[model samples]
Target chain A: METFKHLVNILAHPTIMLTVGMLVFLFFFPPNDWFEKWNRRLRLNFLWTKKGFYFVMFLMVVFFLFGLTDPNFSLIIKKPDNVPIIGLIFFVFIFLWISMNQALKNDNLIEAGEKPEEYNDPEDKVLVWPDLVYIEFIALILCMSLLLIWSIGLEAPLEGPANPAESPNPSKAPWYFLGLQEMLVYFDPWLAGVVFPSLIILGLMAIPYLDTNPEGAGYYSYKQRRLAIPIYLFGWMILWVALIVIGTFLRGPNWNFFGPFEFWDLHKLVPLTNINLSEIIYIKWFNRGLPENILVREIFGFLIVFGYFLLLPPLLAKTAFKKLHQNLGNFKFGFFIFLLLCMLSLPIKMYLRWLFNLKYLIAIPEFFFNI
Target chain B: MSDKKKSNIFQRLGESQVWKSIIRSGIPRTRRQRMMSVLNSVFLHLHPVRLPRHAVKVKFTWCMGGLTFFLFLVLTITGILLMFYYRPTVEYAYTDMIDLGEQVPLGIMREIHRWGAHAMVITVWLHMFRVFMTGSYKPPREFNWVVGVILLTLTLLLSFTGYLLPWDQLAIWAVTVGSNMARATPFLGHEGPGAALLALGDINFVNIGSDVKFALLGGRFVGEAALLRFYVLHCIGLPFIVMILMAIHFWRIRKDGGISGPT
Candidate 1:
């Protein structure tokens, strides 16, 4: 049990979790056909099949029940405010599994040169009065009953009255916005709170425009939209949902990370010496004091930041994303790549922070500018 | 006692002037009558008279969109009830919240409202996911997808603005942390990039007093004005916008060929 707890603690580390998430994602949705045999043997699609899904769900339930045995885990999980998140986890997974199961099945049928399950004869229609309306009525009743039961079972959380002077040790945003709050650890409020959120909305809106491929219209088929599906899952599952989970359960007092079974010791501190790019270049590498001039001191930092955004697009256009560029045209390609890079930057910055204690790429507090 | 007598009684009731005026469509027995039942009713008319069989399937639609709308209705009704006892002012807000749990009748409405709000957020997200997975946002439905993305943001905003209403530490701190982000709104914020550029040698344009954060909080900090502003935005402003957008979203579904299907 101790060994198991240790293993979980290591695995739950953000760096490890994120890396594992990416690996699992790639394993499921490989960039090439190289892992086809491995994928088949693993039965990636079978994981969403009824029997496989039940087994996975059983494991999750067991794990949760087991975790609840530990006081630390139970305290976090059983919190009234966190209850919706628990439901979110289950519902998200269930719906994801359901959709993926259908998608995989549809993909197989399409490969066999048949229509998807959603294909219905237009003439063979159902009246809204009974068919649609009845289903809606049933759903509404079910939802209402569920809400009533939940309301009766658990009380809504109301903490102490408004105290302006003393803030909570780990002040968290509402569950939905927790992902943005988590980003504050690795980024400035400007980038994490404002810019990324705007980009997310814009990018979601841009999906229909960007993804001009009309192969999988009105049906669930992963094979038809392999690229689009994985990218979106990465953003939604890893970036958003996973971040919220970490923020809610893992983060402890003073915004420190706590393991599932570990106690959230209020006094516990992790010593960190975060260093800026200028400090690394001037003081550490050159064995000299930093330059007095701000621009001169942060020249290398600015060059790298500017180079990443400006130069990398053309380089990608010529190499990796050449086909994408050709298909999307210049303007659309540039916009798409910009959005993609912005999304990818989060992980890159996170890795930099973890590995090197790198705080900022460009740090010029004179103008309140940093990246 | 006879089948004919029973039918006659129901038929007579259905044929009454009051029944006709209220129901418009008589007790639907035939296919045409069923279609008319949907067509004539204001609430039911939002849906088309007939839909492709697969469109109504739980597997395909997931009923997430409908549930989200239903949750919104639940919230609005419960919210209006809560408003009767609760005051948005800083002095009364915290006590009112406590009273809601202890003194108010059917005080469980707060729990339902809170949970329902959370559920709505989840449902909206899932709805989007289902739409994306099915490629329902293609071609004619592209604008609707954009509208949906906007609605998703509004849903989050709605939840966020409502978060501050309880006038508790959780509410204030969360909003404070959240609204503090506005202080980094590029040129308009005091601590943001390019704020210094908008200043003369001796005079600064944007500072703590006049920055975006100041405008958002209505002061330098989370206080009375901030509470009132967030209250109004939460109850009225955001919901008003969301309703308009939701109308457009539902309207577009009909215009965009009544939900995407394999062509």
Candidate 2:
């Protein structure tokens, strides 16, 4: 009795009460039934009721119990709107579920020819604290409810209808898309807004399938590997640098593609608008007699594409497997690397544009950086 | 007793002209029954039957993702309401937004739409990152992951298309950059080397070669036609597609079974 009292006193400190409550609930109700059902159906279980959810609740209550006792917690009121109505409906459903489940537990005990107290037996059960379990569940649901209401209420009402003529400076995308918009300044718009972004989406989506060897499916795959580590690090480093560089530089009039707008009175050096590409190509030995700039690019592009798509894949496959053809060849590692390269293409292209701008400035002193 | 109940129901259904009119929509009896079953049962309608709720339990987390979807639904409802007063033309687009903000009855609806969109993106990304951290993208669940990726792309596309509907200078220039980027895409692109390749003598022929510039702008760059196209995509085409994808995504979640990891 003294030990139990001491334990209760320690938990009552409020600094540890939430944690204590969480531990009690987890120790008692493990959500074993949920896991069993999940595993039976999917051959795996990830929804463990013992971790995180209860833990977060425990930490908050233990750490912030003082705050809750203060006036601030009271400020978290339910908003008066359709959101609250939906919340009310959810609350009702939760209550009904809890009541029915409790009743059903009692019914099962009775049907088994056991006393009602058996369901609540303290001696026979090692960690079966139903009260604690119920408390944790309710607390977690309340937290979610509070979060939903808070989200809805935080949104400010519209200031006015949209107007076109009075274009605001630093016209921004919604905060969510600001990251992508920031990329456009340094990159070719296609690279920033489309290709790289597309690759990221594709990469995320392909993760489950690309690594789907059914080996280490649920566990971290790259943790033990050193070979892929550098690549991942490099990819992330490049991404951050690209985002910061583009967002910071290459902004202002014309939404310039590199480090702000710079003067380039190139009409004096080379009359470009009416000039035929064939004349320039004929003058150059490397791209001799090409009718258009595209013709030269295409010729080189074909070589690179052919080598990459046709020759290299087969050569690598033959070297790795000692066989040219195989039914189960996925080239997962190669594809991963290829995807990474695709992701980096935007930043690289953006860099090239920056380089060109610098060269142009150097070539003609009059075409100096504006900033 | 059951026979009498069935007979009465059949007779009532037969006598109702509305039921006959519904049948003329070419809905087979089985399909009608299924839809009616969904509409009739409150709880069952929360989820469709074809979903293998049991199977997807292991490789899916139902909590945050579900919340995000709920938010998306809220945004859709509010967005549709705001669309009633929105004008996408450059001349009146910004004015419409101002009007929505200052005038229109319950103009707060427009604020909700804008804010909802911002919130939706945050939630969706959080959902995606959660899926990644949990290693939810493993075998048998790969296709669903692909679908999720497509959904992500569509989400961004929806954001981009919707951004231009305001028809302000910001909308105009931002979309100009965005569409120009689209035109630079290989094969079906309107610019870069691809455009020249598509040209045969004076006529540039192919999917994106001929009239590509005209089609995108509706006339020239960032004009009235562009705004209308963006408006339709934002309010109509993108939403419809997103809703369908969302439905499929949810169904797939159940089919794939819930979140992956150990208990």
Task: Tell me the TM-score of each prediction against the true structure.
Answer: 0.97, 0.54
RMSD list, candidates in order: 1.6, 16.4
- The positional error of residue A32 in candidate 2, measured at the CA in angstroms, is 37
Q: Which ten residues in a row have the lowest lDDT in candidate 2 chain A?
A: A362-371
TM-score of predicted structure 2, chain A: 0.39
Clashes of each: 0, 30
Candidate 2's error at B8, in angstroms?
Answer: 36
Best by lDDT: 1
Writing each residue's lDDT as its tens digit, candidate 2 over A1-371 gives 34643444354432243234333433222234553354446532112233433454465455334333433222222112113322322332333233223333444454576543212222222211222223334544654465555544554422333444555444544433444676654444445655666677666665554443343233322222212322333343235322432333323233332211222122323222322222333434455554344435344434544465556555655774333125235576456546755655444444433343311101111211110
All models: lDDT? 0.90, 0.48
* Model 1 docking tier (incorrect/acceptable/medium/high): high
DockQ, per model, reads 0.89, 0.17
Residue B156: error of model 1 in Å? 0.6
DockQ computed for model 2 against the true two-chain complex using alpha carbons = 0.17
State the lDDT of candidate 1 residue by residue for A1-371, as single tens digits. 98998789788989899888887877776555665566777877677789988998999899999999988899999998899898889888899998989988998889999999889888998888798888999999999999999999999999999999999988988999999999999999889988899999999999999998888999888878877888888899989999999999999998998888888999997998999989999999999999999899999988987898899999999997787789999999899989999999999999999999999988988887888
Q: Per model, how much of the real contact set is kept?
A: 0.93, 0.24
